[model samples]
Target: MRTYLEVSGGGVMRKQPYVCGLDAAVDVIDGKWKVLIIWALNHRRCRFGELRRLVPGVSEKVLAQQLRELEADGIVHRESYDVVPPKVEYSLTELGDELNTALGPLGAWGKRRMAVLEEAGQD
Candidate 1:
């Protein structure tokens, strides 16, 4: 097993044992619904309904839970306004924008790989 160190202020804070090769940073965003939520919010700010439509097969309860977690992690911002019907919107924070930028290439790679797999299976 490999041990990884957490660095803070350019110094090693503590040593952590690697469990799955992925570090804690990846673990935080490893929730089942997190990536989906991030992908949905990538294009623009969306309301609850819009998000629901964008992410198919996610239950309302799960979506709400994921949003709360994302907001707590400082990756997403939830803004509520005082209005007749109570308008609420969700958008990615600067941190989230950075994460999304990193994920763009991964997403494209997955799409291309899937296409290759489908073509090969047709033979």
Candidate 2:
């Protein structure tokens, strides 16, 4: 078993035995419902309960977990207001917006692949 991972350009061997930046990036965004949550916040900011309703079938625990993770990863921003009924909202950060732009082509490719598969199945 290989103990070290190598980076291509720098001839650098990571002795820590961990994933590189790209792998970490993929890991952060990867989940059954993560993209959905990201996409929901793509257009506008939303509150916690609103996000829960926006993303169907996600339990409160799961949604909260995912949001926390996303926030930690710098993909989402959370703001709280001190009011009688406290208000909080979430929106995509600058990095999040860049990621959303990057994901668009990938989503389009997946859509095209699915359509092709469906057409093939109909034959």
Candidate 3:
């Protein structure tokens, strides 16, 4: 027989959907445009059209889908105005802010790696 030990922290068991930390993070930012969406909303809140403009090559349907997934994962907050010509804005939640900070070093490393790769390619 196999047994799994329940992990409880801060006096409460986390309700995380993924069993592994990396898996959980990957599950939240799985799609191609999700990380870009997170990066775009890291500093400022943006509307649907704004996100579409910021993330080039992404279609309207894909953006909407990614936003919905992010919102579901509790990484992004969606605020809708109760006015004519409806306005909706998205911003990162606390969890998302932490995620952005966590990914910053990785982003920098990727930049350095890209530069090295470019140089290597030229050789």
Candidate 4:
């Protein structure tokens, strides 16, 4: 186990422990919707409604919460515009783009595994 330091709201530092680099990476994207959100925003920025349509099956509330979490984690960037109807667009940060690139091999492996499972009549 290794420890990392994080600052609290009270301006105090605390130690957080993780087993390895993968553990720390997984901690940033530990939810069902986060990866999908990142994927959806990979190519372009999207408004709330656009994101909802792109990521089918996610409720508005959950999507909003997940976006907030991703923003706090520094993986997503939220830009607000001063317009008549109030415009907000979400996009991936540079860190998020790197994370997406890292996930490519995992996604390919999953595709291969799914084919194997389907051939075995298990999927």
All models: lDDT?
0.80, 0.80, 0.83, 0.86
| TM-scores for every candidate against the unseen true structure | 0.77, 0.77, 0.82, 0.86
User: How many backbone clashes are present in model 4?
Assistant: 0
lDDT of 2 by residue, 18-120 (tens): 4576665576687777888898899699999998888999999989878887887778999999996999999999988988887898899989999998999
On the 0 to 100 scale, the lDDT of residue 23 in model 1 is 64
Model 1's C-alpha root-mean-square deviation from the true structure amounts to: 6.3
Q: Mind sharing the TM-score for model 2?
A: 0.77
Find the candidate with the highest lDDT and give its number. Answer: 4
Tens-digit lDDT track of model 1 for 1-123: 777666433242434664763565574477677888898899589999999999998899989978876787678999999998999999999989888887788899989999998999942
**Model 1 CA lDDT for position 58:** 89
Stretches off by above 4 angstroms in model 2 are: 1-21
Ranking by lDDT: 4, 3, 1, 2
For each candidate, C-alpha RMSD in Å? Answer: 6.3, 7.0, 6.2, 3.5
Candidate 2, residue 83: lDDT: 91
Is candidate 3 or 4 superior in lDDT? 4
